[model samples]
Target: MLIAQITDLHVSFDPAFLDGRVAPLEAVLRAVAVLAALDPRPDAVLLTGDLAENGSAEEYAFIRHALGELDLPVFAVPGNHDSSPAMRTGLGSFMRASEASHACYVVDDFPLSLVGLDTSVAGKAHGALDPARLEWLEKVLGQRAGRPVFMFMHHPPFDTGIRTMDACGLLEGRERLAELIAWHGGVVGVVCGHVHRSIHTSVAGVPTVVAPSCAHQIALELRANAPLQYRLEPPAIALHRCEQGQMMVSHVRYIPDFPGPWRF
Candidate 1:
């Protein structure tokens, strides 16, 4: 099965300047077109939060209509920029009824079990998984014992080299998550977004990845005090392919036009 991962949409109701003077909605539309044109379309799309520029109902409504054009089932988790209540109301049809309170749910229709976790803090730029949420996740994982599980959340549990971004990453409860992964033999990997750059790392010996933003990208700097900024780097999407007896494979496909492939 193949899944398309799109993140950090930052969609706004009004046109606003982003990287290279491009509007956020334009970037999202372009990315959606690319997803629509994939040769072998993905079975489902995973949206790893930041679905809105501001946690407003209008923004959520705009994004809901835009996503509806894809005509594919979308699974989502709330990011720092998302409002859990707004998402539940605006995108209610796509969300699981059982997860109405929070954005966490187990997608049951897919071949592999997908557990979406909510990591957004109420009024903070950073993320956190409270004891209640952590306990809930433990119960969910236990129920689906031995099934290949793909965990999705908004904030990456580990820090990337980007210092400013790292400061705003998941602040607590990661150690608990690592413990869960250490014993849960069925967890294939963890997929998340927030850093705005595609990053690969490991947590508790489990493969972890952060998808790139479809709108603008965070500047790549590794110094101790690098300025927080965005750049017009080629936006991209992550394609995760899972087979019967093989490890999940991830590919980063840049969204730019190139020369024709003349039977390479």
Candidate 2:
């Protein structure tokens, strides 16, 4: 099955339309336009949060508008910019009752098993996966034993080499996640967002990926000592193709003419 990963929209009610130089509301809208035009389309759209620039109901409404055109099931988790209750009230309508009603859920089906983990903690710039979430993850992993499961969250369960962003990934409780991945042979890969850059690595010998922002990207400079740099580089989204009993492969595509107009 095909799965699309859209991360870090960072949507905001930009009362002042500052073009691409400011928060990328238009960039996100452009991304969705491209997503809607995909040839075969995705079975599901898995968003790894930062759905809003601030945890505001209006911003969630903005996200709702952009995501509304897609003809697919959308699954999301809370990022630092998302409000748990608000996200529940907004996106919960598309989710199943068994989805736990907290903007976190799992889809174990024909082509793949997706585990949506919520790593957002209230009023914090960083993220964490605590005991309760970990235990829930363990239970889901247990239920899907022997099946190829693809896990997703807003924060990488481990570091991403960039010091500043690394500090923001799962904190002390990461060991539990690592141990679980180490033990579970069915986990084919881990997909996460929040760093706003694409990273491919292996954690616990399992392939893990960080989906870049749909709105903007963090400078790849591994240090803040350098000149401040954030760019309007082409916005990107990830596509994962999964076939049972085979490893999943991902393609990160940049939507061109984004935040602009182009005719076919």
Which candidate number has the best TM-score? Answer: 1
Quote each prediction's TM-score.
Answer: 0.92, 0.89
Please write out the lDDT profile of model 2 over residues 1-264, one tens digit for every residue: 888999988887775523436456777787898899898898988888888776778777777767877867888878888888787777654443444424457886546678878887888878877777778778888887887788888888777667777766677567888899877788877888988888898788887899888877777866654443466666799998877766678899887874422111
lDDT for 262 (candidate 1): 21
Residue 53 lDDT, candidate 1, scale 0-100 = 77
Q: Write candidate 1's Cα lDDT for 110-148 as tens digits.
A: 878888889988889899888878888898888888788
lDDT scores for all predictions?
A: 0.82, 0.77
Error of 1 at 43 (Å): 0.9
Error of 1 at 185 (Å): 0.7
